[model samples]
Target: MTDHIGTAPVRDGLHGGGRRRELAAATVGSVVESFDWNLYAVLAPYFAADLFGHGKGGVNGVLAAYATFAVGFVARPVGSYLIGRLSDTRGRRLALSLGMAVIAVASLGLAALPGQRSIGVWAAVLAVVVRVVQGLAFGGEAPSVAAYVTETAPPRHRFAFSSVSYGGIILGSLLSFGVLTALIRTLGKSGLENGGWRWGFLVAALLGLGAVWVRRAAPESEEFHRARARQRPGGRPPFLRTLREHRRSVFTVFLNTLGGTVGYYFALTYLPQYAAAYHVIDKETAASFMTVVLAVVLVTMLLTGAAADRFGLLPVARIGFWLPVPAVPVLLAGLRGGWLSFQLVAVLLGMLVATVLGTLNVFTGLLFPTEVRAVGLGVVNAATIAAFGGSFPLLAEWLGDHHRLGLIPFYVTVCTAGPAVGLLTAMRVPSFAAAVQEAEAGIQRTPGSA
Candidate 1:
């Protein structure tokens, strides 16, 4: 009970249909986030040279293409600040809808883009431009959607609501894989290689448009309205001051989420590629294997979300961090095991580590007061994703290329190690809701003191 922080008293001012609207918005946002981001990762092998190379530049071309992928992650902080600020001041619905529209435009542009053969280096340049746009959109989209779901859920069901809403990440990735696999099979490898990959982005663009409509239909949170009501009409506080005051919360969000991002990008999104690259299986088998693994992960996420509601968020999340410490080392121990051998262990860890992700957005959003929840979370989580998630594949490939696979487990362990202590210290020593109340009431507590 002590570890279980209480939900906000201002949960969901609107009821019934309003709750459905919030959940739908959150789910669609998660799906779009997963789809467009992973579309590149999934389709990179086929399209990387088309967009980045001088023709059959080998693995080096793919590597160059993914650099743009990393750049996109690096661009997220800018979007987070711009759109997160919008979410807090205007409304979550507007921010969510706007972010989706950005991604939709980016996706459509990428789908229509000509390859390097036609456009030269500008093709790659334009690719980064599009990805940066997506990163910015996602940067804002993620936090706004997270805050909306958390604020709109009933207090007792916050964990479950957050879990169910964010489960769209898995659904999105699954659909991505399914789409690609079907394309590979129907078109055969040559047809896909020729130009079939663009269809994936075309699909992502359509989904982004649909998500924008769904978010528009979703209701705004009562919590944000109340926070705005308390604000002096023409006297909004400067964001710089809010950042300075809430610096501790931002750092805490970093510690809590860094590992989860790595797990999702590496263990889940990158697995099919990792397996195929190492000769463990062909792309089709790897994709099929991951589809099954992700289905299990989805079920596991829902179960953990329900568990968090029944037990507590931190208790459930602590297991998520520690489970990967041992599991990851075993996966790459020999670095050449069969699919049923070490690869299975890797996917298992994927499912387990995802528990933290199931409720992470909601937990992070709740760590701030309603007034600044979207912006702070957007910035910190985007930074964390940029550092860990975006660069994970590159790091793994670099280590594997140099035959240093053994160190990867240590890297994953180090990432997961901080959160157990940091979340307990930062979120629950005095608690987030408590800190927000104290700040509002002009009660000062020294930073970092227990």
Candidate 2:
């Protein structure tokens, strides 16, 4: 059956009506999680003075603040390992609910905390503790959602189905941007600098209420339920053993994620900042540009998800990957022009990146079996995201600082090529197709097959 948004068939033998609910649940969950995470980077610049010791040492203060942000990222893999095991054995609902709860509490903690001026270094210390919780919660959240969606959908439409989950990321980003823009308008620069940013965290905390409702309402996937019923103690393979047996798949996922994740942050998140930092535009204009770009990304994400269902994940992913090689130069040139050029590039090339990134979980989840799917997806994503995602902002800052910004293109090239090559190599591995078939055959053998 087709989803309301598109003509793609439901996969994993999910009932047409039930599949809709599951998709909605996963999509909403993804959006809530992404909104909280993405907002931190964009909002950090305004609040750094109070939180990160901005005047204490000039540039070093900002670096220390960003370092704290990076520290949260460092905690994700640990979150993934702990949460993935829980989702794999206990339940997706429990794992996701708990993670979201932790984020909500941390956000509230941040909202209520005093700034360094009022509370001394203890304020920063408290902020770091909250950030660690946020990091751990987000780390487990994505992989579990991916695994749940992959197993829940019908096989034929799995990729397309998975694409829907990514829509939440774009949706959340746009929402966060909208909220930030509103707060800036209402409070102005001084007001925002003082405490308006704290309101953003409060808004984030409120989302947990919606997340809880969705989690409670959505039923567990029937496939997952069956897997639990047939549980065999000690029969489940160790994560390392399963990962070793499927090392090639792990490598392929890492390569695929490395390019897509880095490219995504560059185009959607980092580019506008680049424009502002280079004096091409002012802060408001840069934020506005990114907000518009994210809006475009949101629309494209939904369309890409639908397309992935129709064409299969790999083919659509390949098209998204290769399209950027030509567009990157154009984007760079456009950025050199003015606002219109940047917007044009944002709409065109932004869509290209979203196509692949929007459908990443669908493809990644299919690469592993149930035994290690969560752990495998988590590790690969964590590694690629940590290396690529964290590095881009730092690299951009470094290049700009040195006036060697032209090197940015080479950086993009390497990021794009690494994944493209891995994907191409993955296609040739005999086990890729065989594993997919085996998975399908297992489903077919199930009683009533849903």
lDDT of each residue in 233-348, candidate 1, tens digit only: 76655767767777777777888778778777877777666666667677677776777777878888888877766655556767875676666666655445653553576567
* Model 1: lDDT of residue 393: 79
Q: Please, what are the lDDT tens digits per residue for candidate 2 over residues 179-230?
A: 8888888998788888889999899889966786777767675556666667
- TM-score to native of every candidate shown: 0.89, 0.89
Clashes of each: 0, 7
* Top candidate, metric lDDT: 1
Q: Where in model 2 is the C-alpha error above 4 Å?
A: 1-17, 55-60, 229-231, 337-340, 428-450
Would you give me the overall lDDT of model 1? 0.76
Candidate 1 residue spans exceeding 4 A from truth: 1-15, 54-59, 233-236, 334-343, 433-450
Candidate 2 residue pairs that clash: 11-153, 11-154, 11-155, 12-153, 12-154, 12-155, 13-154
TM-score of 2: 0.89
